[model samples]
Target: MPVIEIENLRKTYSMDGGLSVEALCGVSLCFESGEFAAIMGASGSGKSTLLNILGCLDPPTAGRYLLNDDNVAALEGERLAALRNENIGFVFQSFNLLSRTSALENTELPLMYNHSGLGMTEIRRRALAALDRVGLAERADHHPNQLSGGQQQRVALARALVNEPSVLLADEPTGNLDSRTTLDIMALLQQLNDQGMLIVMVTHEQEIGAYTRRILEMRDGLIIRDSPVENRRHARAEASGESTTRLNATES
Candidate 1:
């Protein structure tokens, strides 16, 4: 099933004068359930604009956006906020964790805003479980400063997963990590994707993009290329210095 669908989506930003910048230009796309895909482009290519609209952080100036079969453009105010909180999860390049809070507490931040009637006990339990999924349960009490960059990103990922969202959106998720740590993070992501979590990531690096099952390259506010990986990178295999199969890319 298609969890996300956008048709002729457009976004524009107005300037002081009678002028505007079109960030997204009549872009149409669909993401099915359990799909692992990446959006790639240089600066000003509208990849971020499209991601914002999909995550419900911004509304399109024109066109339809459907999330889990609901028309997202039709929602406003609290309704939109609720939809975003309930179904979409986000991870950023910065790791975005609070400096003062413990890893568990950082993961609990999303649930705090949800108002789902979950008690503190239940919330903590869920948060801990999320941390455990990312292999950081033992360090739950550690502050951001105490954790390494990769561990911090794991906390961020756990926070995103705590809500049981329909899809996970990551923007340059490993941009701050070293190469070895990048592989570790990507391995965790691959494990999650294997277990049927839908993931869409935005990255400028082709090597990082190679880990995903599909790649969508955007340019000038349009998707110039949409191709499936004939041979997707297996994070664990590469991490162990084992050979990974690669097939020729065929257009989709």
Candidate 2:
């Protein structure tokens, strides 16, 4: 079954003078387990809106949205929050780590809220494991300010993954990083996806989108193109100074 399924999804915001702005217009898509997909668009193209809905941060104005076969569009309040915490992991452009907190503590925040049944020892164990997954186990005691941009982002990713969520939602996760750091982050994301994690990322840069298996191009609140990437760039290969070119140059 698909990890995510949406049909004719729509979202609108009320404006002045009794007007409304359509942020999403009849959007529909499905994402399977272990698939890596990118959503790309210019500002006002509805990509952010789509990501917000996908992350369960907002409800759709109309339509069906299913996460792991559960109808999220019909849920509200704590039920929705529980579903989000249980099934989804989020990474934002900003690392969103607490300045004064240690990386391990920051990564433990999610569990504190939703997994209260877990003891402190288990929480610490899981958080440490998560940091290890992101290649930051040794830095677990360091604060966000002590880490580089890429390392901070890795901490954020570790926090997102600590719960072992079924799907990962990244909203411009590499937007604040330099080119080399961006490639490092992409390589990490790709590695996670290869391990059966479903990833859906929002990015405006075509170069960043090239690393994903599929790209969904949005324009004016609609998907203009939903196509497979012919020669998906491998970040590890790129990092090793290998040529990263499309198998079919015309695929884009």
The lDDT values for all models are 0.92, 0.93
In model 1, the worst 10-residue window by lDDT is: 243-252
Q: Which stretches of candidate 2 lie over 4 Å from their true place?
A: 242-252
Q: Residues 1-252, candidate 2, lDDT per residue (tens digit)? A: 899999999999999999999999999999999999999999999999999999999999999999988899988778878877778899999988899999999999888777458899999999999999999999999999999999999999999999899999999999999998998999999999999999999999999999999999999889999999988999988876733344335455
Query: Model 2: which residue pairs collide?
Result: none
Candidate 2 Cα deviation (angstroms), residue 184: 0.6
Residue 33, candidate 2: alpha-carbon lDDT: 96
By lDDT, who's the top model here? 2
Q: Distance (Å) between predicted and true CA of 35, model 2?
A: 0.7
lDDT of 1 by residue, 42-93 (tens): 9899999999899999999999999999999998778888887789889999
Global CA lDDT of candidate 1, please? 0.92
- Candidate 1, residue 124: Cα displacement in angstroms equals 0.5
